[model samples]
Target: MPELEVSYKTTSKQFLGRVTTSKESADFIRGLFNEGEIELQEQFIVLYLNQANKIIGYYKHSKGSINATVADIRIVLGTALKCLATSIVVSHNHPSGNLHPSAADKVLTENLKQSAALMNIKLLDHVIITKDGQTSFADEGLLGIKTYDQHTAFVQKVTEALEQKTKHNKLSLEKLAQTFGITDKTEVKELTELAIIKTARILAHSAGNVKERFDKIVELYHAQVNLSHRTSQSILLQQYSTPAPIGYLAGIFCEVDKLKEKGGYAFEPSAGNGLLTIAGEPERFYVNELDNFRNQNLKTQGFANVWNRDATQAFFDVQGNFNAVITNPPFGTAEKKVMYDTYSIKPLEHVMALRALDCMAQDGKAAIIIGGHTNWDDKGRIQAGKNRIFFNYLYSRYHVCDVININGAKLYSRQGTSFDVRLILINGRKLKPEGAASLFNPLKDVEVKTFDELFNRVMDAMDAVTNNTFMKPTNTLEREAIELQKLFTTTELISRFDNPPPQEGLGEALNPPYQPACESSVVLNTQVPDSMAFETRTAIQSIKEAVGGDIDNFVRHRLKYPNK
Candidate 1:
């Protein structure tokens, strides 16, 4: 077993002189500092006084630059307690000869008072000393501490009285402040303005017309004793935040003609305030929004078939088919795998595309906007691998009608960050299961410098689709042509065509143009020339490393395509 001991001691000395009033306190504080010390820089000092108002001990808490010095409330309270002080007086000097108490001075005095009270110590005064004179927060009655609840209630009562009277017959703000026991002019104005703004926002939601709402809000403000309101006002304000520019919405709707008919059932799976769905104005529309506030907004706007639920869950259980589905789902969210077990589609954009397909009519079409990672490169060429698996799957199932690259400026709100935007247009008709999908560069012919230009090109394309004059899907044929053209344009092909080998030692004189199938150790056949043997061996070594050595099989490939 171990033994423990505790000890206590008091080494502080006693002090004697009483400081009852603000002037006597200020004079004692001023007398402590010499004229030379006061002229150097700003300094904060605390004077610990006893129950009889006698000075016990004093501490210079901080020394700062010519303009200001920092004083920590903790240091002040600790020093008072250490010195056995019952009351304390704090002071600081301003080198600029100004004796007015700053806004920070008033706040600091209130905080010190509150903290000292907690320790069972009284705060006598806070004085600002200057070259000219001194000012005391105690003398001005600014040191009286009031709780936040008391101030807020007073302001609300005054605001209610003002709302009940006409503009010409209203009570003066100064008189109202005096009646409410609030002395500071700045606080009176600030609290009044805050109360007025609170009323305006609540009434803004109740009525539509400007003058009518203002009049009605005044009537309600006067009749009510208290108003229940949202603690966080920004939540209501952010509901009005614009998600995307109207021009981008217009551009999406420009493809209306591409649908099986001009008008039919439409749906927005991730409807945020129903902006796109409401703007598109399909004959019949449905919406799904995860946010409860936005769902209520959609309902207030006369959208009845709105489902406030997670998109993934709601989409999984969706009942009816949509003729046209348009959506811009949340990006950068983790998507869980459901319904399809074979495919490992993880990105939210890719998952939304697959889910959108599930709820579409057999002949339905869709326009989707995806994030930057799928569409852009530094050199501005289509890198084509980010969403290659998803795109290939689409081509295998449905016809990918068009692809467009929307400039960042046209896709987001004015205050939003710039990002790369990609749109994919799909035709609901299914393709044969056996063949691969074709890829084409539709953006090559379209000018997307401005929203208008982009919208016009989409409209023209939709017109062609509706008139049955759309371009045929020759994507596979175009890709084959491009490959053959590249082969003919190679430098090695040109060199081989211009020069021929001697027929006498045809096999021995000619170096194999292609790589070998294997690179296992073996002696070279002496019949082959030295110059051609070095190049042939090197090519064979590379091929064997890549495909595992099959020498005879590699030779047959070279013979099959002699020029290549």
Candidate 2:
């Protein structure tokens, strides 16, 4: 009998296409399905791609009943290996017209992702398709992974540039001081400060306006840092910066922009790069950030005063001076407990809130984002422990106006974690004796499961409140909040996959075409091509030896430097 021969062939003379976004991937996959079968039966399809994300081919893995399908991981990996594909996008169509992934869908996706990693293949995204629309696991952050993209790349580049400039300026300043034989520490410090200011101005001008520059710098801090190191640091410090939408919402409640227009003073305790202050657009603002890097960033933004002291100390000299205080303070307990008179407020968020209140003028308004659990449980009842003491203290002393519960999953998806947060809008003025007595009786918290639910509860609370000049009119505030919600939701949903609008003169380089270093060619008679055979063999050997049989490291190495 003749030896059996296996060969790979392609019908197309050119590449099918390259997919960069979840929407594009969905569209390409949808076009491959049989229109008649798509609505009648569930089908699992996988698209194999080269390192550049250019589609190599697609395989219909399995087909089953209307609502479910069985997908074999071996078959999927086998096809990818045959195609020499580096990445895969798995998608399935739902006959029920629901874009949401079922429990089984999520399980299958996780399994496939892990399996692909073992084989040195990237599972880029898992999409659910319906006639109406598509849902991407990557876009929704369901994959529980972070992939490097243009935004991260840009931030990394900016960080490198900044570091180089800083080093050069420092060396030059030292050389100048040596040449002049100058030993005055104050003079050297002043000169260094001037250099930093000049460098910041240059970066600010190149990046764009205050908001744009602030965002870029924040991204630089998050992206350029090592993930594990940063995670450890963050946990120790309880440092989670406010998302832009949350910052804007806090600003709206605090009326930051209006205060800015009136030349009112604002204070932000535990300001992370002054994002909250930027949202308020306050002309006169004082900020305190414990992190040295973040404090330097605040200075770069040209804030009136950027203090690097413990915020619990309450800016003693400037106490009772601020018109507005807007902040998202560090959550969890402080390393050293803070005392409120004889009472101990162990929760760092509460300490910061109390400090903010102290820093505010008698009529100052504040919107503080704190851990939601501090006020109520999931069932809307007050929680036990230190929370009760903190709430009682707050209600008995300050004018507690309204609390808006924000869904952390929707807000912090990019950060790859979720927790509930509450934005408490407060007045610095002490509550009237009768009002304080009534509020201190018992706390009635509203149970909220969704954004809409929490929004309605907030609106109702606003309606019940009387004679509060800090809050805008009910109709106006409602309309503005609704608009902001719409904008925020739209921005979050589409931001993951959408390409930034092209800038003038940058042209195609802004969104470069996918180009693989080694062109994929047909394999015949189980023979590997000489061009890729050496690299492939070496990569496999390196994976087996150096990485202890971990394919993920090898695959990432190849993808990072494709030409090698």
Candidate 3:
């Protein structure tokens, strides 16, 4: 056991060494050089290990600055195989007496942690050696580790970038930082640079004035807005975040012709920019968004009916009837309630607290954006799979119509998310079990049995189910769709964990685990999914993995096709 423990420690040490040392180890090593006499520049070396602590051939392959070196993830670890090192140690010399790590040094170490994680290598320690003694990052509890401070900082940076996404409308960097609770001007400048390019791309596509930029920014910002009135003034300020692609709001005008056929009712429980309202859904629409900034913009745009109110309380406050309910509800939690970055780190109750209009008229048609995993349910505890099932169950009752799947993942490649948007159409009329109930049902022309038959099936079902019966027994179709939806809610995954990442995108974490799957194997151990149903799930997973939760990609792709 002692030998095993020692071996483990050695491997951990070597793994961390490679991470902090260099990302790649392709070139030959630089001779220990003298930088201004006392300043020694030593490359951070990764010691790859086998079973225990053992000597391995070093990848002396970095020739760069005086502080740190980068190695290719594959090459750095590959050295371990060649040297047959059971465990490795990372050692670096500080030419100067200063053993403290620089900001760059810390960042590189974290990036290495992320990479080592992907490679399944253990990160042990990062020792900063001076002429006198060695200072270990692991000993300091900094090896392959990051404090909550860094994570919040990262979220703030990303948030700043999202705010900048609307800067084309001329939102000053300083203003955005303050909204996010950053009082330091230095942080504002730092964050602007991070997202300026992406923001420019978004702005370049828009044709708007300075005021308009602020207006557009409100949508992005309000997505993360803190709505509580009793909250601290600091926390109450609107938290600007990145607005997803406008493609995310596709089909806002969908079934408009049909919606007009009935006495019109339009409601947006969480209207950000009143995107749906502006798209011309209802003549006198009612919008309930907590962010005053956005609501004011809507009111300025002649949406006087808009109000700054909590959406969850819509049931109690709004007494008006509705013909259509359209919105892209914040698919995740509200900023004031819980903290989240790109992906939800932990399963917080806030996720369940933010459901779309449960009060939609049974016969009203509704559109809402949701995460791919929104349907889960943990024993009515609210999970993605279970939510979808419950949503289906709710719609199956009277007043709910068809649920339309909005394919939004095929376009955006930002994060790997299975989340997408869908439209749930309900009319005031109760849908019968057997009489062409599906047309009244919403999912038509949305989800697919096979990618090839996607739209055709939607149209045919809508066409064929015109005379459905309400009491028709649940059959194979309902069972199959419900089963797939359940996967999003039932299957468990790592809600949160920590690791370092590459400075450039796609950095790995030290031994960071893969996302838990409904049926997961490190290697593709299961037989290939060959059936149309299985293939459909596979296609969905492929799209989800490519973009995480951003749904604009799929929306853009589907829009390219002619209206079905």
Which candidate should be chosen as best, given lDDT against the real structure? Answer: 2
Clashes of 3: 94
Number of clashing residue pairs in every model? Answer: 5, 0, 94
Task: Estimate, for each residue in 120-223, the C-alpha lDDT of model 1 and write its tens digit.
Answer: 88776788887557887766667784433234455556556546543311236545666656766545543553444334434533445433543454453334
lDDT of 1: 0.55
Q: Which pairs of residues have clashing backbones in candidate 2?
A: none
Worst window of 10 by summed lDDT in candidate 3:
20-29
* Candidate lDDT (C-alpha), each: 0.55, 0.61, 0.42
The CA-based lDDT of model 2 is what?
A: 0.61
Q: Model 3, 366: alpha-carbon shift in Å?
A: 1.1
- Candidate 2 weakest lDDT stretch, 10 residues: 433-442
Q: Tens digits of per-residue lDDT for model 2 on 324-417?
A: 8888878765644777655578777788888888888887778888876445342222465677667656655666676655676654433334
